[model samples]
Target chain A: MRLSKKGAAKPDPKEGADRTKDVLGGTEIRIAYKMGYVLNFYREPSFRKIEMELGITRPEIVTLIFLNFREGVTASEICEFSGHLKANISRGIIALEKKKLLRRDVDKNDNRRQRLYLTPAGRALYAKYIPALRERERAMLSCLSASERKLFEGLLDKLAEHVPHWTALDEL
Target chain B: MRLSKKGAAKPDPKEGADRTKDVLGGTEIRIAYKMGYVLNFYREPSFRKIEMELGITRPEIVTLIFLNFREGVTASEICEFSGHLKANISRGIIALEKKKLLRRDVDKNDNRRQRLYLTPAGRALYAKYIPALRERERAMLSCLSASERKLFEGLLDKLAEHVPHWTALDEL
Candidate 1:
């Protein structure tokens, strides 16, 4: 019989120390930490696989998503928009450009700044990936109901209201 | 004037693109990811702080917590209990012993296995850190209501259940 590619059999939790099993709500800490842990796993394969398959990480997807809504966006604007550090955005822009997905042009009005626009290829790639990415996103969001997702998004906006440096994302 | 030492600035979302800001829904992903991110940021500092203060890391704390409940834990057992990989637990034991926080005794009945126990210092340190940690945990948890935290933790656990492998925490 063939085992699923996901992994081999699950390790029995019973064999470990019994006393530690329920210690200090051990179960909850494990649960709370799971989403972050799973994100790492999901990202590694999905980003690499999808990026190789389509050539973009989710962050890059965010970049394109925002850029589509507003063209002539600056690197600083992207840093602020994506909440990604400048170095990461800089590197991402470099990667996207290397793939000929986009291009950067010096702002005619501001020499100190550069404006970003998607190349024709970028537009095509974005069109290709968004649907697939949205599918995956929908699947992940399926864990939450529509009303729950909206309320959760609202609460997230509240908690997230605290991050001000994102305004200076250009300095990122 | 000097900026705050920790730079715990809250992010402002209105200024940036709203695309990725609430993409994951709820502050759950942002808060937790930020916690993990902050933990990673202070990882070196946190590790050194614990070493100088209590001789432990976040992962080691989990180990000590588990060991406190049950002494004489084997490497494989610790790995299983902590959801860490074998390599991580191995390294963790080596580090704990180096700090004199824990000791591994060769199982008399089983030559191939060893049992781990925390030193007196480990217990003392745990007692000291627990209160401070509990406070920070409460602050984070306060972002959600009692019921939301319950549902959130459940979602996180379900997420972790899907991940195949994590860091080699067991060996560490």
Candidate 2:
């Protein structure tokens, strides 16, 4: 019921404001509000950068990511693993095939199903992007102490686990 | 350079199977990506709830939040603080005035400048929503240990402050 003084939640902005985040000077902070606000800021450039530089869109990369992690999966498996739209996954499969990053092979058991794999090229692309992706992650988390980072990441999973689904958010 | 075993990052899916969050039971994880994804899930319900039950749109509620945090600020200031568009701020301001949630008064020293404040009704509305909001936040973050929750909230601010602006994300 009490609104704390502004900026009481964290250290001085002068210390942390190196460049990426648009942190308001005054902060009557709410956990969910601030987190969602920040996610909006961070999402655009990463998604756009991957597209602009690699000529690969999010669904494409996401499909590749699933393939990289778990090969021998079919398009529907990718859909189940990633929850991407069926159409988007189909389009992504086609785009990745065109890029030669992935190859779609017909299932011997069922000709109707196409098993997907990260081609050597696609695997290379994933490896190449790892550094950049890791760096971005590092920068986003650089503010946390080593101990804080561990706890924060651990808690993130816990909170994420707490929600059975998005609809659960409305009830909460 | 290392991709850990599956489910190393987030909890196992069986633990948090929900309709909204498409929590991947995989090895790769990124702070910003996962957060943004969850935010997208949480955002729809809260926003839709406000709109359906209270008739306040997202932009309108967001504007009120900023005003609630930092009163006496101009519309342009809210835009700068939240990175919201000037047009959206103007529209929100008009909506709030119509709803009697806020009042605008011209600055005496600068006749051309108008300052905004929450009316008594607005403050009451804010108070009314506080419990529901706190409840939602608690549920979203309930998985954390008490100590972890403390560090998590603190780190959220630190990381948020890390970005001076969204463009800095491109550099990262």
Candidate 3:
């Protein structure tokens, strides 16, 4: 769809030619729009594929991926890292436990808290799902040359590294 | 929270030191994780502020932002652009119309279709809300040098422009 309505100022002919660029708006919101645009494609299609193939919900997939990397963590930690709601993550954990894909143990240090770990079945499921994610990422980045891809990765690394400093909104 | 469980292999000493990097995991999922991490901070905080101060829901805020650039579009177009569910966007449009922040007009080309436009009040509210979003984006990008920021934006633009080509996942 066209970003600018009829009779709106069109400063850039190139932008007008590219519908995607037009939909992204001007420089003020361009960064957010572009990032959101790319991320949407990444999440929406992948989530659909995962759900259809694996019969897992979005939050469950997130839990599986998180537990794949870091076991022995509380659901709260997964909620924090995944940006999912606590209730959703909790539900996901419960569902996974029921499916025998994950198991929980009482934290030795904190009896009230339960830590989550992936079962062997969970690991195998994650292994099955991961190659699709890898392939998706490869296709997404195929537009760039090898060096450009590396540069893009480095830039994303810097942004990710800087997240904690500005995540809190109390100052805003 | 630590990404790797205790006794997990630490292939990169530098990665071990940076909690964010660790949480992002290896190259296979690093890009998705990094993008999600940054986008989460962008959405979660800004959404909280918008909800608290303006009493707008996430979908409503998305509707406002999309209409700010492009008027006379259908809710379906907004859904497609924003990556939000159709139900949420419909609810947002109804809410915004009830608030007198947006108005609908019959599409001249198609009588069955109604087009959405921002009311003057809606535009004013969007105007008031945009600076904070702009500032948030600026703060997020402050980690990069001017040249690096330009390069990063270019990379994002490339990815955004390329989205339509690979967004469909029938082959996957």
Candidate 4:
């Protein structure tokens, strides 16, 4: 594995107990802390793969992911859903448009409303992207059983519903 | 809440069914997608807070988070557990040692080994860093119940242990 390529830098798993205790002592919440760490761990490879394969940056891929799932969405919906900045999403929209992978059309009822969708080419690229990325996901969870995976996915959605609060607590 | 301050960008709740099907059609996995989105959603504020409070970058804060939990670890162990690049971790160690927030000592049994630990000043910075950052975390998960939080944490650990494989499928 790329992560373990160099034997010198693998996690000293024996200290797992002390790591958990000392890190969790102050916050009383360990999940989110570890969540941040682990996601960062996976982020580089994901970026490397996506960039090499699709030639798009992280934000653009995120925007494409959103449009792939929800066709006819406005740029604003992407901002809300993906937590990307408006400026970044706009740039992504423009970049994809320049590549002819995505197109935006005005809503029939509202001239001001722009709807975004993947072009045929974009859809084709998305097709190529799926298997490679999903394989990584599958391998990552290969340790879990089908039932455990179910429980795990459900728990993820449960926490995901809180996306709205991610930034709002600053006000409080 | 910051996410809802402008009603226009909110993800339409009713689109859940269609969005799930459409998005997963390409990838067959939505949980990791959402996890990536939601985590990025919280990252900015956490970075902002840590930088303001502790004068550290995202990678630095991540290193500090690791050391906070497991003091007396080597830089390589940090790379293994935190998934940061060795070059980056080494740089972080140098920066922290320069700041006098962290100290490294040679192992008595192994003269070649240098172990890292937080200094009193580092502990003080962590004291300031916790409440501000954990608040964002609390807000991000305010939607979950106490029990759900427990399940969610356990599941995250399960998934996190799989970090090594996230990018290793190329060999498979």
Candidate 5:
């Protein structure tokens, strides 16, 4: 595991002093790090109540959210849309089906594929759980004024739409 | 599995039209969804090469990044800083130790606690892999102008610092 340190500089005292402060502040990775930090707040705590009350995992909640938005989508589509692993989504779909919250139908146009839809139970579960998500989001964004929120949303839209341009590591 | 349709309104044609569009554009969950969308690009592809070259998982790379920033920290500290699970951070620490890239020292003040530091090999590995991360971040943020980037950063800082207020499920 050792690599040649031929060109590696000695750790400077000044740099060490700077490193002792925060995680990513004033660092090259701050942007991504900060974004991830905020996302973490959304990931675990935001969904904790739903996960406990409904006996569903984060992946299952994600599946419900996606199906709530668009019915008759395949697992791969959910994976693509949610950025979740195919295996996780597959497992969630199976669990939701077993829980009687979701159902699958053979795609009429593609016999090899199955499309997912929420059962009435699933829809009701989503309805019951969505307000919490909305409230959490509202609280998270409460720090911003209405105009600042609009500006932030626009910036986010720009970055989200730009994902394809920079997502490939090989391209970098 | 069927839910009572007592108060459930009929699915409107306009709402279905909106649903057929892109994921999370005009929805209540758009902020979180957009942030996650941008984050997925960073989470998977940004670290793909490093993962391949170093034979380290995402959690392990995250471990290295955190250690690089501040050494002599515990796994729990890393979890708090990185928003990763303790089990994953513990696993990464074990793997890094096995690879001889990291070492732990028992705290003199508290023998039950251990502090982690990067080995020379680990430092070299971090040095080599960090440029790619910097470049990826640069590319990701290149879309924004300098002023807009500043604004976005401020918003992120506000949200990240506000995490404590909204992070608890019970608070919501």
Candidate 6:
């Protein structure tokens, strides 16, 4: 599609220096932007593939992939791992449940909690979709050396360690 | 602000792959994401400062900076150097013009082009903002050694050479 005319307004350029100082001028900031750009690019095309082939949005696919590894995981748990906020996960879960791709059950142990599990359909989707996801990842990362990948990941883990709330929010 | 309702949604679990691939994988992807995120964070905050105190976005700041270096530079050229598009450049010019931070005059050499130059107010803003921009940049690169920074930037340049549009769009 051509660019959206309504979205043409430039983003708000005014924000406070306090928030800016939080993540500014660090290895984390530089790496974050570069990766964010690539990820955005990577997602745009791959999402088109997911939408066309599986009838899923990019975010839903991410949630679905998580469900494959930890069945019956709580929404909170999902949020912690994914770095997405709870609402997004809830929306994806709702959409997936509607499609019969997964089911969300109340946690017997914790009434305030909900556990999510993939339905057979969800599993089938995973089986069919995982290779494409993997392929996209490999293509995007093809430029890195093994050693570089290790160092880069270690640095991210360091940064992730610092963002506890973001991590916590990744869980339901 | 308190977390938005959208922020309250459960997070996805499968962001591991993205995190792992981009960061731990030691590829340029991590750097790309970090740089994009931090630059955006920094730029937005600075722009906010400008709006509240000086009233201009980074794009306009970019125009000012480029114009200072080479008087009467065209919008297209500024857009190219700033890594923003023509539409963005146009919007920035409009904003700057409104603020009287800068002026655009028809290029005597090329009517299809407009040359940008900072007003005295713009020059003053540039003197103030440039140091902050550089400081933000220095802080972001702090995690790496000077040599590492060199290597990292070199690698980024190589990637840019390989994919001139890598930073331009979301099409991997």
The most accurate candidate by DockQ is: 3
TM-score comparison, 2 vs 6, better candidate: 2
Per-residue lDDT of candidate 5, residues A1-172 (tens digit): 1111123223232332233234557345888888887787676666776888878998899888888877877886666557777889889999999999999998787787788989999999989989988888888888789988899989987777666555532222
Predicted structure with the largest lDDT when compared to the true one:
3
Encode model 2's per-residue lDDT on B43-160: one tens digit a residue.
5556666777778766677777777766877876565445566787889889999999999999787787688999989887766655655666666666667877777767777777
In model 2, how many backbone clashes occur?
Answer: 10
**TM-score (C-alpha) between model 3 and the true structure:** 0.84
Q: Better model by lDDT, 2 or 6?
A: 2
TM-score of each model, paired residue for residue = 0.55, 0.63, 0.84, 0.76, 0.79, 0.53
Provide DockQ values for all models, in the order shown.
0.17, 0.28, 0.39, 0.34, 0.27, 0.08
Q: Tell me the TM-score of model 4.
A: 0.76
Q: lDDT of model 3 at residue B167?
A: 59
| DockQ, ranked from best to worst | 3, 4, 2, 5, 1, 6
- Using lDDT as the measure, name the better of candidate 2 and candidate 4: 4
**Model 6 lDDT on a 0 to 1 scale:** 0.55
**Clash count of each predicted structure:** 30, 10, 0, 1, 0, 55
| Candidate 5 structure quality by residue, lDDT tens digits, B43-121 | 6666777888878988889888878867887876677557777788889999999999999998887786688999999
Q: Which 10-residue span in candidate 6 chain A carries the lowest summed lDDT?
A: A1-10
Error of 4 at A24 (Å): 9.2
- Which residue runs does candidate 1 get wrong by more than 4 Å? A1-24, A27-34, A37-41, A48-85, A106-113, A120-158, A161-172, B1-93, B105-116, B121-137, B154-172
| Docking quality tier of model 3 | acceptable
True contacts kept of each: 0.13, 0.36, 0.56, 0.38, 0.48, 0.04
Where does candidate 4 stray beyond 4 Å?
Answer: A1-28, A41-43, A106-113, A165-172, B1-27, B52-54, B105-114, B162-172
lDDT string, candidate 1, B30-116, tens digits = 433433332222222323455568645556776776676667767775554455556777787788888888888888877888878
Query: How would you encode candidate 6's per-residue C-alpha lDDT over A1-172 as one tens digit per residue?
Result: 1111122222111221221222122322343333433454445555677778888875587677667765776665555444445687888888999999998888776688777889999999877866765565555555667776566545544334333222233222
- Across A81-164, the per-residue lDDT of candidate 3 in tens digits comes to 678888888899999999999999988877877989999999998898888888888778888999998899899888877766
